[model samples]
Target: MSIWEMLAVFAAGISAGTINTIVGSGTLITFPVLLATGLPPVTATVSNALGLIPGSISGAIGYRKELEGQRPRVLKLTVGALVGGLTGATLLLALPSTAFETIVPVLVALALLLVILQPRISKAVQSRRARTGTPAHPDGGPLLFIGLTLASVYGGYFTAAQGIIYLSLMGMLVDDTMQRLNAVKNVLAAIVNSIAALFFLFVADFDWTAVVLIAVGSALGGQIGAKVGRRLSPAFLRALIVTVGTAAIVQLVLR
Candidate 1:
């Protein structure tokens, strides 16, 4: 790759890491840059998945405080994510590139809608919980497990707004503050991405230079996001997610 291309990927990685830490959909920032560098779609997707793993890990660590008392929740949900991620990775390797391309825009659109309506959804969830006098299901019952598994499968396939999907679902079922639920979302996303990365590492052709650049940039960006992102207003963050998700849909359609 040319130095300019490398620089662009690095910059995209920084933006992706920060966005992933804050709200998700970081793939929208990085995937097109990889394509511009002349990688095939599958190669770019897999390489990007691997490159962002460190950033996901860093972001999860950055939210360690919020992770407190969430061990059982994390452990239980991780199983579903792992299985779903493996299933998605296998499908990615097995299916034609056109199949993934066809679905990604729809996924982005759904994520955008979820971001826009999350406040109403949260309120409804709170109201329902109060009316039923049922506590939040930390274990995330069968319905939550199924939903998470599906989201993980999507994350393994595209990874754009997987975090947004997770946040929306968890907000309804997990019965916690947004910040705490966000912490859980980060860890679950990391698990899904890590499983997919491992699959790609063993089975796919990837650009090592691009991966390295993204890893370095994303890792640094993760730390920056963790330190500063918590202060941002939820409204601002949700707006940012919607904007990026809309861009992702446009990019997919144009491509």
Candidate 2:
């Protein structure tokens, strides 16, 4: 790769890291950047997945305060994400692109709709809980399992706005402040991306220049995302992510 290409990847990494930390949609940034640099679709997807692992890990670590008391829960739930991510990645490699293409638009649209409804739904759920005088959890085990499993499956497959899916699920199924759940989201997302990245690094062809550049920049941007997260209201960020995710879905649909 030329110096310019390496720089472009590094820039993409920074953009992805910040986007992932703040709003979720790091894939929307890095994936296209790599594709523009001439990687095949699958290769770009896999390589970006690997490179963005650090950003996820970084964001999780940055939220250590929120994670301080949630270790056991995180461990239990992380397995679902791990399994789902591997399943998704393997499917990506093994299944024909034609099959994936047919399914992705539907998934993306559904995911975006979830993103769009997050605020209103969360408020309504909270209001219902308050009126019922119930403790934080109203749904219990089956709901928790289903929600995590769904998030994991989505994370494993394609994590454009996986945060929205997780935030909505965790908000409904678990009782925690949005900030605290955000920490859990980072950890689960990290496990999904990090594991897939490790697999790709060992098995797939990658542009190492792109990987290194993105990894470094994303790591830095991730730290900043965590630092700034609470200061900024997430309403606008969610709106932007949904907008971009919708655009990406539209592009895919056209293709």
Candidate 3:
């Protein structure tokens, strides 16, 4: 890639990392940026997955405190996440774009709706949970493996706003603090991207220079984002999702 492409990817990585750290829709930022650079849609998607792995890791680590007391939960759910992510990455590698093209926008729109309603949904969950007088541990955390697995699969494949899906699912099916749930979400998200990145490095096209720059930018952004994440209002991220997501959809449709 050219120097300009390197710069854009790096910038996108930082933005994505920060957003991931704060709100969990970082891919919605970088994926389109890569597409604008003339990469094929799936290629851009995979390359963006590779570039964002480090950022996801950094964000996961930054939220480690929230992961406490979740070992059993993580253990049970991570298997599904890992396996499903591998499958998702393989699907991306094996299938051509035609298979996913029609479905991609639908997924993005779902993510947008999830982000848009996250606050109200989360609040309502908390309120209902408070009145329920028991952890939603019915059938032991709801056996949400299928949902988690599917979510991870999506993350590995496209990963636009996988966090919103994660947040929404955990809110519904799992009995955990929102903070802890979000921590799990970040870790699992990284796992998906990490698996996809591994597959891409050995089997798919990549631009290592751009990946390096993006990783560095993402590293710094993750730290900064995690440090002051709580300061931002939901309105800010919602505005971002609407503006950026709408723009991305428009560009894709126009293309």
- Candidate number that wins on TM-score, 1 or 2: 1
In order of appearance, the predictions have TM-scores of 0.93, 0.86, 0.81
TM-score winner between candidates 1 and 3: 1
Task: Please give the range of 10 consecutive residues that has the lowest summed lDDT in model 3.
Answer: 134-143
lDDT of 1 by residue, 119-190 (tens): 888689778889999776666688889999998998898887788788767765666777777788889988
Q: Could you give the candidate ranking by lDDT, starting with the highest?
A: 1, 2, 3
Off by over 4 Å in 2: 123-134, 138-140, 234-244, 247-255
Give the candidates in order of TM-score, highest first.
1, 2, 3
Error of 1 at 191 (Å): 1.2
RMSD of each: 1.7, 2.6, 3.4
lDDT of 2 by residue, 40-147 (tens): 887887778878888998988888888877887787788778887887777777777576567766776776776677677777877897999866643225676667
Clashes of 1: 1
What pairs collide in candidate 2? 85-156
Best-fitting candidate, scored by TM-score: 1
Taken over the whole model, the C-alpha lDDT of each candidate is 0.85, 0.75, 0.73
